[model samples]
Target: MSLTGGSVSVRHPAQHRGRSRLSPQAYLATTGRILRQLLADHRSVAMILVVPSLIITLMYFMFQNAPHRPGAPSPFNNACLIMLGVFPLIVMFLITSITMQRERVSGTLERILTTPLRRLDLLAAYGTAFSIAAAAQATLACVVSYWFLGLYTEGSPVLVFLIAIINAVLGVGLGLLCSAFARTEFQAVQFMPVVIAPQLLLCGIIVPRDLLPDWLQWISNVLPASYALEALQEVGAYPEPTFVAVRDIAVVVGFAVLALCLAAATLRRRTP
Candidate 1:
């Protein structure tokens, strides 16, 4: 970047043959900057830390009076376990996407890219910061559900919290990828219905995958959210994480990694 008269222009980073090496200093600096920005926003902080718990609390009451089958878990308990994963994914997706989009619109991302920061460095920084926020968000939601809201799972609450954190990180990855296609914050908001809602309906939270039509089942099989819901369901049914549950957790992690790679591939030093 240079100044000519009163105008300043950014010189885009030259294309490299392969992925740029991530620098420790650049990664830490970028991560610190993004973390600072996130902490500076009170609204984002509230949404991240409180919204999932609030939603779970509301669901608890809404189903409080519903009938319970004699031998099976109450509907509220089942739904609460599944939602513990979903809410984080949805909330983080929205926050991360919008925040990244804001950085792009403000030219902060471009300026940073023009420096020694590789795309991977910037993305990893965003991931690390959001992952920390996600851990807190998942922890609060799990604590409230198990202790305050009377949610119970056959498996350990620790497993449930871990799944929720993974789901939240998955959200962060998808959000970053979506932000690349959105020119404005409102456009990023519009992506929730397109990207998240379908997953919600199809993830076996609303209806069991076995009960769905064969084609819908096939589609659900391909969505990352389905694996998350399945993992939670396994945890609910078993006292320990089963082989299926472990496999499902691995699938969610793989999908999150894929989304992050795609997001990095989509990054541009300058929007055109």
Candidate 2:
């Protein structure tokens, strides 16, 4: 009986090893599970999708009523561009961190680790799922701003849409990285100041990077948000894709990939 049991265990592991590569079905299952979880949680849905839209809408109305000098750039376009870069960062960062922390706290992550799931598979699923949500959020925000609030851009709307999606995906990557360090939802939220606020301050939204103190300008050079906002502005200002716009977009996407890789490396099977 002992020999038989030992042989069965060895064969089981060998069979598992033979199938160790990431399975598409498993990846899809994980993605679907996350999407369904988001759907089931009305508050999560509201926070992730609705709240950003509401804020953007309010900003639109406020700027819409403001007076503009003849031939001056419209405040609507300015506000839309800022919101395009910032809102997704805020929403996706909060949602991804909190949701992942919840899974860690609930032992779901640990249980998943005991199964055949690969870390890459899990992270890729998350990245894909969140990117989809980010795309939707970007589309809705852009449509509302352009169609209803009368925001205008000289650049192609397709470029604007693509940049917005990339920015949102960057948020997801940063959120995942931050979540790995946080033990609770509150700690995850606290990361906003550390991971996000600095980027916002130095990303040339308020003061142009060149106008900042030399050291601060140096700091802005390394931050992903700086590139993202720059890409957004470039696209808005240019009618077609420019070399600078493409370079900035590439940088932002690179940062997203790096952060996600780091997140996968830091992910723990058990809560510490």
| Top model number, lDDT | 1
Which portions of model 1 miss their true places by more than 4 Å?
1-20
| Winner by TM-score | 2
TM per candidate? 0.91, 0.93
**Per-residue lDDT for 1-272 in model 2, tens only?**
25754643345774785478877888889999988888898997887677877888898878777888988777877877888888888888888988889999999998887778877678888889888888888888878877877778889887888888888888888998899999898999999999999999999988999999999999999999999889888888888888999999999999999989999999987568
lDDT of 2: 0.86
lDDT of 1 at 249: 98
What is the RMSD of candidate 2?
Answer: 2.7
- lDDT per residue as tens, model 1, 23-53: 7887888888888999999999999998878
Q: Per model, state how many residue pairs clash.
A: 0, 0
With a 3 Å backbone cut-off (N, CA, C), the pairs that clash in candidate 1 are none
